[model samples]
Target chain A: MNELVANLGVSYGDVLLELSYLLAAVFFVVGLKFQSHPLTARKGNLWAAAGMFLAMLTTLFLHKDADGNGIALTNGIIIVFSIAVAGVLGAVIARRVKMTAMPELVSFFNATGGGASALVALIEFSNPNNSSTLVTLLGLVIGSVAFSGSLIAYGKLDGKVGDIFAKWTTYLNLFLLGIVITIIVFILAGNISYDSQKLLVYGLLVISLIYGVMFVMPIGGADMPVVISLLNSFTGIAAAMGGFIYHNQAMILGGILVGAAGTILTILMCNAMNRSLFNVIIGAFGGGGAAATHEQGTIKEISLSDASILLSYSQKVVIIPGYGLAVAQAQHICHELDTLLEEKGVEVKYAIHPVAGRMPGHMNVLLAEADVPYEKLIEMDDINPSLPNTDVVVVIGANDVVNPAAHDDPSSPIYGMPIINAHEAKNIIVMKRGMGKGYAGIENFLFFNDKTRMLFGHAKESLQKLVNEIKTL
Target chain B: MEQAFEFFYANKDAIFIIVLSVFLGIEVISNVPSVLHTPLMSGANAISGVIIIGGIILVGHADVSKVSVNLILGILAVLFGTLNVVGGFVVTDRMLEMFKKKK
Candidate 1:
């Protein structure tokens, strides 16, 4: 293998490898462009995967060492074996992971990518001839933070972690951030001798890891999508540092793309909640607080037969879905009820809030999984206007997005946030097991509206029973 | 100041690529509808797995004959990077598969 690669010559291999990287970058850009619409999204993903496959295959065969020689057979075997095992493991896990758990799975994958980048920097910095200290250190710090922060996010999303929202947590996070920046400056100041540089690097790594944990410690569940997006950007920039260190064009382009995408998403999530990104970072939102204790009006209960009749008779109905819908795994049943209503000559559409579920667009994915037509799923802005004229609005396992408090109550924690205007509809039916605050831990005033009727039960059961009732009606 | 200029001059091409790619990324992603947000995110996450190439380079250059830090870290990097790349793309494809037009 070595002789064959040696015959090919270093310049030829390097040129071919660089060309492959360029082709891979093209695939990624085209792939991302294809993602703008649902029709091209799956094909776009395949293009990006092909780009990844080509880049990896080229690297495996054409990669040259400092001496301009192909990789040793032993090292090649190690790379192939590790990649094969990890690739199979990743595919199996991804294939079997539940759709509702997609957010945590994304966070878990982001963590591994960050960990890999950090390890790359660590290994490079250990090299005696390494000259790019600043780039390496930046990669180390950013990668470590992304690695640890993403892990905490995964834990939070998986219900394995709890929020620690204390006033002191904010202070503690800021203090650790200060230490991390200060230490980085000290290390780069040239005041430290070479003998102690490794110690300082290790110290920086540990502090950054701690900072990552503290950064995410106080963020409530509702605000997690923003935090995850922000950390995702961090991982991208960290990978870009690796690109800078190695002068790798493919890494630079791919990293910048992800960094920009994550930044846009973070801002979008913050905007959807009508909150500033700074406030989200300071952990000022979500979780139960003084605001949640405000007094509420009496709830009215509606029978399944009445709810069924209301839906069956309505000219137009909009179903607002939230994280609760995903929790009950009732998407299929929900779809069935909607399909039945459509058959009855009643118009049915789903209104999706930007941050409706655990992650951005989570509700859309769940509904799409149930084979809901792409056109039937409407964005909040698009659906809000028609919501008023719609004869019936069914609040299915959703709360925060429909809460009237976001519009009318200034003192409310969710005030100034845009809502679906469900109160404006002529009839409202809310499906829930009991009167519980939303993930943001705020009482929903929409439940008390004159037109609203609470239908208490698990989402799947309620939807199933409703479907059966509608059939009888 | 001179040192900064020298560094910039040496890496100007890379800097150019980074600037253009950032704008391109923002332009392309800004238009994505909310319906495709999850899949788009997962797709970008997979692209970040390009760091797997970096891992491959590290591993290829590592000395396999000895129990050294380079070998251990290099192998781990490859393993994690591969997981991120393969898993990210596969999961994204799975999500996108569900999004279909009305029959």
Candidate 2:
């Protein structure tokens, strides 16, 4: 019976399964296209979920093995149980994670994607299919690295681990890469027996894991977005390798999309920070203290009443938020303050830098959590030209992004990086906790500019104070 | 080992499809606005979570009802893949839910 099914090469159930996968792939493409905009994004998500459900149900009920035996009844139950448990856990966590912790959650989830792909390659290789050996090995290497790298990124984002930059660490990572490649070449030679080959493969996995951890250990928090993006690309490519190994078309389609997206995102991240992919890979910048060289300006302070009056009467106000806003959990109050200012007829908008907060668009999500209108949020370039004509610019807990030194001061480590142009406004009021440098570890000259007044305090407390004062005025 | 290359060579159509899909993927995601980049990343993570299919096939076709290395690994793959897909889509939806157009 199995031989007969094989000879037919197009069983009815198999043909139906293939069509379902094709439908699922089409849904994925359309879903991604919808996700590019705010209006249809929710429907797009549901469409993709439907596709996933369709593919999963078909696989569970209709899939047959090379021997043509249906899924073992007990294994089917176990598979369902595992999926249920994981889906519930994921849904609960996703619901529970705050906007402030989105970066950590994203990093952790990317790790799981990488880990799953790696496990697939590992299990398949344990059985030693000769024809798919190369792709399996390739998947194992990339997936293992992405898994470890993403975990390290999560740790750094959560502040659980600190940078461990040593000149030798970079060399150590490169050395491990060399060993990984050498083992791949040896395995491809096929001189070793199966048992010994398993040991060699395990060796490769361990080294790849080590290299991944080391690869991320040297970079500081500010560089995390690019690292996360690059690792995302790695996971995508790794999953694609699994698809190739198993002849899975859905995996192939999904993996390539993610790979392309991740790669593009990484490039965009580098461009946003005015850095090269090579420079970023070299693990340079983001020392957190690398920019603390000069202290050549007098402190300028703003009184609470004066700050409130200034904002309440301003014709236009642009607010710039940063990682500091997240640290203070002040997004809600900030939005409230913006609302209050608007009621008084002050035209208010937010200038969002791409690298603001921890991840790409991290600040936007944070502000959105506070129910800020999407139109009030403006990109850096779109808002910069408007800044000079603006009456006042209020900067909240943001530092490096609003620094003027990036355009001048060649000696500054952040030179050539684009900033918020907060200096261009008629009045620049900066709200912060203290006279600390930003993530790049450099002092912001904009604070010393004659047009700037520093209103130093906790971001939430300061915004709350300003909001109260605005009502009184 | 040479046969592995031969197998890949025989699947030329799959290769062509994969390569073409790669370009399509890049083109589609290349212009995702910076604001949606995080959701895009999370959403794509969910899509790649389709590797769960690969895991399902692996454990399902193990040819036995008893415990084996394959069984354990397949279960683990299912768990991770499900978490990725579910967590990714749920979080993306959660984020998108908060976005409202200006009144």
Name the candidate that leads on TM-score. 2
Off by over 4 Å in 2: A1-8, A128-130, A286-295, B1-8, B101-103
**DockQ computed for model 1 against the true two-chain complex using alpha carbons:** 0.80
Q: List, residue by residue over A154-189, the lDDT tens digit for candidate 2.
A: 999899999898899888988899999999999888
Fnat for candidate 1 (0 to 1): 0.83
Q: After superposition, how far is residue A398 of candidate 2 from its true place, in Å?
A: 1.4
Please write out the lDDT profile of model 1 over residues B1-103, one tens digit for every residue. Answer: 8878987887899889989988988998886776677788888888888888889989898877788877898899999999999999999988988875444
What is the Cα-based lDDT of residue A223 in candidate 1? 77
> How does each model score on TM-score?
0.94, 0.95
* Predicted model with the maximum lDDT: 1
Q: Which run of 10 residues does model 2 chain A get worst, by summed lDDT?
A: A286-295
TM-score of chain B of each: 0.94, 0.85
* Steric overlap count per candidate: 0, 2
Off by over 4 Å in 1: A1-10, A286-296, B1-3, B101-103
